[model samples]
Target chain A: MKRRTVGRSDGRKVIVAAVLVSLLSFGPTVRRSDGQDTSAIDRGVRIGIIYRPGVRPGLVMLPRTGQGLDSVRVIVARDLDYGDRFEVITLPGGDSIRLASTTGPRRSSAGGSTATKGATAGALNYPLYQALGADFALDITAAGDTTVATLHDIAAASVRRSVRVQLPRSSDPDFRQAVHRLADQALQAAIGTPGIAATRILFVKDGKVYRIDQDGADQKLVSSTDRQAMSPAWGADGRRFAYMEFQAGKGWLYLQEMGSGKRTAVATTGSALDFTPAFSPDGQTMAFSRATEEGTDLYTINIKNNCCLRRLTVGRFSDNLSPTFSPDGQRIAFVSTRPGLPQIYVMAADGTDQQLFAPFDYGVTGASNAPEWSPDGQSVAFHRDVAGTLQVFVLDVRTRTVRQLTSVGRNEDPTWAPDSRHLAFVSDRSGYRQLWIIDLDTGRIRPLLQQSGARLPAWSPRLSEATSSTP
Target chain B: MKSVSLLLALGLGAAVFAAASCGGNPAPQNTTPAVDTAAENQRVRDSIAAAEAERARQAQAEAERIAAQRRADSLAALARAGEEVRSTLAAMIHFDLDKSNIRPEDAATLDQKVAILQANPELRIRIGGHCDERGSDEYNLALGNRRAQSGKQYLVSHGIDASRIETQSWGEEKPLVDGHDESAWSQNRRDEFEIISGGDNIRRP
Candidate 1:
């Protein structure tokens, strides 16, 4: 993997540290980031890249010897890059002897495996790294049934954090996530910020739902191959997701627990289409689109209570669908065809005060669909048809202005990452529909999954380390 | 119940190939028999009107002669109308891009469907709405739903029982033609009427 310089201008983006009051209701008590801009709290981190690039500490990955160690180095570097917090400096190679343990022998309790000596400093050339513009460096060493990771602060020349991670076998399906978990830990120790590298994404490909990593590795089937699944939505807890399965000539929404793969049909009407299920950030409610003989309307059900199915927008011969909840769960941003063509609309969470949210001319613009609200509650990402092709666009909620993100081949279905600075969307730039991620801060676009036919990607929240596996 | 079982069986077989549209074969278009229009009936009506004028001039045997001519015109209209019942039940009406409301041009076709359903009380139909490949898949589904509903609403508004018509949206999943141009899209954005039951003893409405 190659490392690029973080240009100064591209590094500035809106990031707000929203303190979500873990309340029982849905109306937003969120302390808006844009409202707090220019206030006294702007001294430190805002999301990932809002900090001054000058203060961005440089980092490197030291090479080591062990079976399957090379794959670890590659994945961890990609993870660090995706984290967007570290100024990752890629070295040609590190001394292999630096892998040997310098600390005295100790039992490894992490993997519950008996092993000698954990991670410690060997022959680290700190001065050479400092001259090469690196402030921190990560080193991984493996010996006697244990893989140990050590983070070093180049300036202080001291070990910051060290732990022995019992990595799953390279052939196991959980191997990639285990390594990502390490990268998340490294980020926390380096900057005291939660990293989204350990998170996974859900997308629909060829009529089935699939899960992929943030860096485009470990693409696996999340829904059954026998059942046709589309429009996957992730819960904030990261263990539950909802999707629509086409069965018996109708589409129905089903909620699935990833661990047991137990899918229970959610509250929806029979003989009607139910799709695009979006769980509120509070995880207490779910909003979806249901089409009846009358018209297509937006509805919400109390997911936690399994009752209180409330209709939000009355289609009245027009369509209101694709509901994405704001971070505070107080408002929902959805696509409404009430204007004769689909446009982004926002409404209160309790189904009131509906109005057009995104700016567009009635006759001058094309149809916009699939609007997703960022976790920070600042911007909404969506795709609109321009001329003949569809392109991704971002709408800053405060300014009410729109910016086109992609102008290449047709791009649609923009989904925001937990970090709020990255988005995963379906783009046909390569001639086939695939999932792509764009960094809003740097305007960097990369493919999240190489698998063709991927569509409707939904990024998950920062997953905890214990549940980092398929569940 | 029978209609539900019949469609479920057909959907299972098609679902596998339809979702995996890997360019093996072009999609099969809506093939249900349908009458394009009752042009033959229109011409017959004109002739009947002309005969009435002739009968008025010849008042000697006016009653008998006019009755005989009236019977002949009735038979001709019945034959034409019967052809519409069997073939035109699955007839499709086109829609504009992203518009679900029925177009003025498609009104006459839907009116004919209303007549068919009225004449046969037991008749049931399924209106499958479709769209072109231009829009997003999920959005297209909702649009297609409105398209199907629009056709149903038109029939229901015309006095047909709402229960007799079932609506489904194929979205952009099933296209009648394979192309990216307007020609293919115009054909793809349409509502197809399929008979679910009561077509055995066809009769003119």
Candidate 2:
């Protein structure tokens, strides 16, 4: 009779947790965000990083222990929230909930929260937390030059996973990025996909190229304020970038290193008006648009040796500009004006097999431009004019089926994050041009930058080179 | 009327001198006091006529000086020949949406430039194409290039040396007007000319 009563109470606890989660969650709402209706990519997305409706997992950060570890706790919590896979509970100050502190040596298995009782909520009063709607909690203990993070499942009342991440002293230059990488790994451990916290987005603000982290911190200007700079892009390694700068009545492309600030102007063509630089996946070649009296055409040069400048298109009198290379480096997608209005067209990297990539009616659609191939090679994101306003659109590479992703405001320049599930674009939704990020699966929209006058968002590739190894 | 009066006064003085001459030179017959008095009166009338003619001549000179000053003032309001030629060269030629071909009206504008270039062989100029903010940055760059190149082609075809003209495209980066509607856009989609060298004294077209 006693065993039956215990079982009944356990079932009631699970039911109460589910009900509370539903009441507090903000589900996916409607947004053109700008794309077309009736897309297969939105329906039967087998491999999409989709989130279940009305079923958000609750996450909490166990109050940090040890000095100089506050940033680790705060950043990880913000990152996981931005990841859009959790309901990140913000605990009030001064120990609103019971948290066990660990000042001693790190535990061999999982620290604190003994879980010796097996199959309960937390080590102390976890059943109470479960009743309060927490699904998981992260306990972080700072050790010498390393931080130990223990993941605890509240309802199961057991340890889930533990990871020891390297975090140099706060004075270290890369200390913040190291913390960002740790958050990415935590999301990878909590969910199946890694977070984009470690990635940096390059954008144009007040005619200068600026770089910002995913959490909206450390906004640094990468280009000179006096010089005219636009269309900044990076290769897969994220070590260097290519952008267009004006000099002596012509636009010149420059390759700049992120580490030592070394810059060199491209040597392919010195006479024509050149702009819109894109790097190949291997970082060996750069494809750009050059214009002359004959016409505007696509051109590629071997940046590794800075020789072998090759022409990609020859539509004389018709403009062919804005080249975006495919993830495999075999093909490039660009904007061409051959069919009345500008349209997106794809061609082989060797300037062969050129064809229209994005489909639109002759007189129906306005214009399609700024096509960017995703890092995963599954889709190409660009903006198209719908009626009179420009909206963001995505094309599935395999099916060639296009879907509109935004319609709320004038959204343009859809650049994909390294994770491929989020896009950083410029939108005037708040009455001014600003950078906003959208997660494809969760349908969550958040402003990436606070200031207006920001455009040409270029997301960096995954920044885990120096801090690799997933949790 | 004033000229008629001066002519009448001269005529009267001439008659008086003739009477004096006739009376004095034709006869040593009469040495009458009344005849001498008449000669004195004639001399006095001649002197008055001379002073009046001098005043009239001075008035005419003052009128001419005022007219010349007015003409000079009007000329100052007009730009110098070199400045006018520069304005015609600097006159921006506009293009249709996504088009670079020279229109008939814009061709007329270019013809003015060609004439200026031909008139001043030592002159060299650069044409910069621009676009509205409707298209993407990359697309606008190409469109701007085409507009500028087409203008250069027009000048070359009109017998202006290609070497004397340089072309560049500012794309939509630089705008003559800061607006978003058609008024701003129409003004933005244009080609501007700047003197590169040897424009110290441009000959008017």
Candidate 3:
């Protein structure tokens, strides 16, 4: 990872502090050098050169040659498209675009051109791709645990990059996960950002934690017991989750391991109501809300042994809770009722310099809560009370401009996908509360589950192949 | 019989008086012959008419005063009822969307709860905080807890014991209304009170 220079402006420093705190804060805040006016910086952040919605790059997927590679093609195509950075063109009538015919098994160490000769020459057909309005083409070849992905820049008539990875074995239960890793690599090769298809979304439904794939497949009930659960949070390691459970007439925070289904109940004051647990980006510290007679405030606990308990917010009269760390773990955006209503507030990780975020109308826009920092550290998405219904809104931390995302029904609890362009939220637009995903750039909203009664979705970071191998 | 002097003047004078009086009272149900009888009859009729008009004016003023007093009384009674409603245990105070602070409009309602608790020393009450079905469940619980605390704080400040009031948060788990519309959500985001001990034992006579 490359580090950018921090400009002298206060807002710029704040953005840098936010990004330095976490590069996965959502997306990178607009970098403004010294001597530029605040208005210019605002404009630059909103209309930045990278990740513009309208000028999406066009890419095409070619047919793969191997057994047990059907799932890989489907996963990669959908994952790349879901990133909202590419226009993936498939052959007419939904047929796979065949690259070349191959003879028997052939493998080589350098460049691996012996088996891909015909495929390589045919993939450079720029006129065909130009006629189809594709700017790049992808050809994937899989054999056993190894897969090679070649990306061709059609307009440039040259191969852009090739990514080869030893995926999980076809017989392994996590084969789809390995495929997701390859998809992410291919995306990184084509565009600078990796795809989030390999990530999982953790949500609460029926008082339990449920896990689902990024493409809205493989819905699994991860929490085994029937305890009332809330605030499902994913760890940075991608194999652990923490949630608040109501048991024995008290609120308890439980940390669950994905592989073994083992859970450890983190002890807090027996009389205090502890909930809303969020793991830091480094997975070493856990921040949560602890309710006592004084008031509900944010607190952090060491995750290794759960020994170091630290109070983050001092709310003698106000209610401060729901702490989400910036990707760098330097700043936290939480909900505070200090101004007479629950509104989003950003403060340093130690809880100093708490300031109201994105000045919103107290009565008109309602109170903003459940704020999740974007991975790039540019924006924060939260649900505000608009009239009586809750609607999702994204605020550009740099510009202080807000964009409302949902208007119908009641949409809330927005969690950003790893790509930062997409958000998974819980909505009741379909009559019952259910999980829904929206690509902010395209205004495309789809239900993550056909069934209802889902809330509080927490998206996982991009799942590395090493983590997936634990299963 | 009557004797006339200066006949031309007498005829004009009599006709002028009768016309000016516009059918003046016909001698007030009495017959008497006097030199200035027509003038006397006109003067008596004018006095009686003036007395009647004054009486009607006084009657109208009295009615208006009575109506004004009634309006003021009615308004005072309504105000008292509103205050009573605010302090009642049945009244549920609503908060702003994500707010736990008692809204100014709801302060009177919580004050009503405080008053009820003050009046009934043996009364133990529970305040349950709730949220609309919009936010994350645990945060809602935390929000709900704050809301309940806000109400409890108001009660304590008003001289109620903290132990007399227990707080719980249902969050969005329980809703007063089922619909997803604003009408339902606004109703759901509220602090409701339940009498835990006292009201059951006391019998109102």
Best by TM-score: 2
* Regions of model 2 farther than 4 Å from truth: A1-57, A63-66, A92-135, A154-156, A166-173, A465-471, B1-79
Q: Which digits, one per residue and each the tens of the lDDT, describe model 1 over residues A1-471? A: 222223333322211111111111123222222211111111111213222446567677764545557788788877887666665755333321222243423333321121223454644666545544567888877756677778888888778888678988888777888888888888888888878888899887777788888887777787864777789999888888999887766888889886567788886544588888999988899999998876778899988878999999888867889999999999999999888788999999988999889999989899999999999999999989899789889999999999888776888898888889888888777777887777676555667765677888889988775556554
Decide which is better by TM-score, 1 or 2. 2
Error of 1 at A367 (Å): 2.2
Q: Each prediction's Cα lDDT score?
A: 0.76, 0.76, 0.73
**Please, what are the lDDT tens digits per residue for candidate 2 over residues B53-126?**
88898888888888888787656544476678889889989888767788888878888988999988999999
Per residue, candidate 2 scores C-alpha lDDT tens digits across A1-471 of 000011222444356444433433323223231212211122110101112324456677765444578777877777777776666654432132233443324332221233223222235346644654567777766557678777787877887777897886666667667778888777777766777888888888767888888878778888953788889998779888888887788788999887666789898655777889999999899999998877788999999999999999998857899999999999999998889888999989999998988888889987899999998999999999887778899999888889988878788999998778889888888788888888886566778867978999899988875522211
lDDT of 3 by residue, B1-205 (tens): 2455568678897886677567666555333345368778888998899889888888888888899889989876766664554347768989777777788888777776766677668888888889996665656787888788888889999999999988877788779999877899899999888777776433211
Q: What does candidate 1's lDDT look like per residue over B93-205, in tens digits?
A: 98898888799988988887888788889898888999998898889998888899899999999999899888888888789998889999999999988888887666767
Give the alpha carbon lDDT tens digit for every residue of A155-206 in model 3. Answer: 7888888878876666667877777778888888887777787888888877
DockQ comparisons of all candidates to the true complex: 0.47, 0.53, 0.27
Complex DockQ, candidate 2: 0.53
Q: Which residue runs does candidate 3 get wrong by more than 4 Å?
A: A1-54, A63-66, A93-124, A144-146, A156-171, A429-432, A441-444, B1-127, B134-139, B150-166, B176-205
Kindly list the interface RMSD, in angstroms, of each predicted candidate in the order they appear: 1.0, 1.1, 2.4
Better by lDDT, candidate 3 or 1: 1
Error of 1 at B191 (Å): 1.2
